[model samples]
Target: MAAPRWDLGPAREPLGLIRALQGFFSVFAFATLGGFQGSVSFHLSCAGSPNISVSAPFAYPFRLNLATFTPSLTALCNRTWARDVHLVGDFSSSAQFFVVVAVFSFLYSLGALLLYLGYLHLYRGAGGKLPLGDFLATAAFSFLWLVASSAWAKALTDVKASVAAPLPYCHPPAVICSRDTTTPMGTLNVSVVFGFLNLILWLGSSWFVFKETNFHTPPAPSTPSTM
Candidate 1:
């Protein structure tokens, strides 16, 4: 009679909860450059217009000023950890959305790594040591936190401005993912990429913890008698 053994885990982080709420959040589909987050294609946009530059699967007819743009965006995914791979700039409106997504993506990516590591650590406990991936991961997190803080501040300001406008309560510049903005969302995409990366990192960490704590271990083999 151990108190009926009815227990629930603590509530998860708000960010994680929000991320889970979004049914279709995935870096793979987004990174592949051939998908849509609702009406907006996840493709990078022309540097300063509402037009798109590159389409998914990376073919020709759908390609544009590669010399100027393509390299910059794809560079973020160099398959190596130490290099600065993200393409920076809020070129076009669509590009701008990618920027937002990119910042978020960056955060999510790191979150994935951390969460995954956390899973290993929890599973093995003392045996599962997370091989000190401190440098790059730490840097990514620090940078993400700084950028996120800045973004939140700016977003708050934007909210104030929007509310002051002869419009609805706490209105955020409608169609913010567009070029027509009094406040330019230039690095907006960059920050967002980082944010997404953080989200992924956090998720992976959480998963690691779950597998470690909740996974059922098989019964141990019985020892032979030493008569």
Candidate 2:
């Protein structure tokens, strides 16, 4: 079977438009929600640690889980990049994770939606060369999912420590982290969830789009057929 063309054909303009539109919207959304701010993407809570936890209010001593793991946990916590914070809403953080997860959650959703649409259009439209734009749009969506998922996974933890006493607002009544976060109906939470599913959907869509991309990517110039 002949491979697909990478030229993007006549659909180039439309596909490019899609890519540009998505990029513009993503940037706009992030900017609107303060997602661009580096500091906004983290949350912090230190229940234990003289050497591990950061400067948090209402210090609560760490409770050792497995004595053997104490040193490992401490090492993880003390990692220099563990500057805890949150992107969407202030959530407690035992580690410097989830900030990007929440923010990219929204971004991923956008990517998934676009990639799906792009595939639909690419297949449904008249046969033409798909331009670089086709590949670019699909690529962006895939990347968005990858980023959001990584951040999301990193932030997952079952351990909850009351690292903060006098439970402050948005603290989940425990040391969820020292970040000011969502209240269920809050805007940031909504956006983050949206981004999460968006990423998930995009992952699904991206797989298909990648297939479509490959399906359409032209085979290398055929050597003149031997007589």
The TM-scores, one per candidate, come to: 0.24, 0.32
lDDT of 1 by residue, 128-213 (tens): 23222422343444454445435543543443243223211112232112221132332333334444554555445444334333
lDDT of predicted model 1: 0.34
Clash totals for all candidate models = 45, 32
- Could you list the CA RMSD of all candidates, in the order they appear? 17.2, 13.5
What lDDT is reached at residue 46 by model 2?
Answer: 44
Weakest lDDT window of 10 consecutive positions for candidate 2: 58-67
Runs of candidate 1 with Cα error greater than 4 angstroms are: 1-183, 212-225
- Model 1: worst 10 consecutive residues (lDDT sum): 58-67
Write the residue-wise lDDT of candidate 2 on 1-227 in tens digits. 33443444423443334443444444443332333111111244444432222222211111112112112223343343233321122223321233343345445445534443445455444243343344465566557545643443333222122221222232332233443431121333333454455454444544444444436554457689888
